[model samples]
Target: MIELTRDADVAMITLRRPERRNALDIEHCDALREAVEGATADGVRAMVVTGEGTSFCAGADLDGVYGEAFRESLYAALRATLDTPVPVIAAVNGPAIGAGTQLAIACDLRIASDTAVFGVPTARNGLAVDVWTMRRLVELAGGAAARRIMLSGELFDAGQARHYGLCDRAGDVVAAEEWATELASLAPLALAYNKLVLNSPDAGVEDDRLSAAFDACWASSDIEEARAARQEKRAPLFRGR
Candidate 1:
């Protein structure tokens, strides 16, 4: 249901169920969460998420799984992506609908292919995106764009997506993969800290948490290792603490 490949510092996670247009089922969602968590734990500095065939992800597997359990599993996969320390890049190769769109939005960056389209068609099925999911859309594309997409259950093409700031870049998969690798090559501490700060709440609530995270880096052996690696003219191996 999921294929995980490690390329240097980047882990490529692909949804392999093309037979169903890569519709997310319980097993597929579970596998995705596990793969993402495993990559983070294994010192992967970044990840690229894409689908195997023409469709990046077509949303929930209505024929395979539905109801509360399915929704919970989908939520878990998205939350895991958010919780990971390293960056997760969504390489949308095709249409991303419903839960599919949710997964892409959860990622730190979305790199869509020229052939890709993004749609949140939950309204078509009489479903509502959860609170956090709706907020994420608002955060990415702002309130007006979010309303236009969600309320109308409209599908936006790659160009429209770019206009709305839904995708950072739209290009070939190879290019997207290379971009992900470049991101993975950056300093792990800086990458994690940047993501933490970007997703943190207002200064009033984030000061303590941000300070603690920064302090942890200062206290970590990885900091010393980074210095030594720099002096030695080699890459630093960071063990996330």
Candidate 2:
């Protein structure tokens, strides 16, 4: 289950199936994708995703883990978060294992509670994640740290997550909300372009698409507003134009 709420411009998505540790069932995954899509369409400037109770998400439900439908839905939900125009923050309140780790990495930022733990222990279960997921882990936390987590099948705590760069900060949902609120106040167009560039597989390549995005940010009305605000010694009101 997913609970969607809004605090001004920040959208909050809470995984509500605590009895199962918010594990991803096919229906739950579908609901998550729908919630993200709906929230983005509603023009939320930022988003924070967390889980209810003591676990952020305990990965996929065992009953449906081997089903192709569940995998498809789960990956779709992760992709929806990755493709959202606005920034997404993961508020990891507790353990985030297997697919739970995948979900967190898909977000633009991760803020983990002191009690949170992270891991991708599929290797221990004789399972394997897709190449994209593996690469994402490496990108976020570096190859050595990724290997320590996946190869050893070890769970790392919040402090270790921050040190390895898997999580941006160690705090609760409130801290995550504070970061999201700050992001919501920034220039939307620039943030979107930055996220697009950062997430691109060929980010190091010089391409027309990348060039266009760069140009668009410079040409945006928000750039002018920023300059005017600096001159007036006041905060700029960005309209996302």
Indicate which candidate wins on TM-score: 2
Clashing pairs in 2: none
Regions of candidate 2 where Cα sits further than 4 Å from its true position: 203-208
Q: Total clashing residue pairs per candidate?
A: 0, 0
lDDT of 1 by residue, 1-241 (tens): 8999998888999999999989998999999999999998888888999999999999988875557888888989998998888888899999998888999999999888878888887777877778887888888888988887888888989998888899988876677679888887666776787788887645554587678778777877887888899999999777654
Model 1 regions more than 4 Å off: 202-208, 219-241
Worst 10 residues of 2 by lDDT: 201-210
In Å, residue 169's CA in model 1 sits off its true spot by: 0.6
Model 1: residue 227 alpha-carbon error in angstroms: 7.9
* Candidate 2, lDDT over the whole model: 0.93
Candidate 2 lDDT, 5-114, residue by residue in tens? 99999999999999999999999999999999999999999999999999999998888789788889999999999999899999999999998999999999999998
- TM-score, predicted candidate 1 vs. hidden true structure: 0.89
Each candidate structure's TM-score, on Cα atoms with residue i matched to residue i, is 0.89, 0.96
Total clashes, candidate 1? Answer: 0
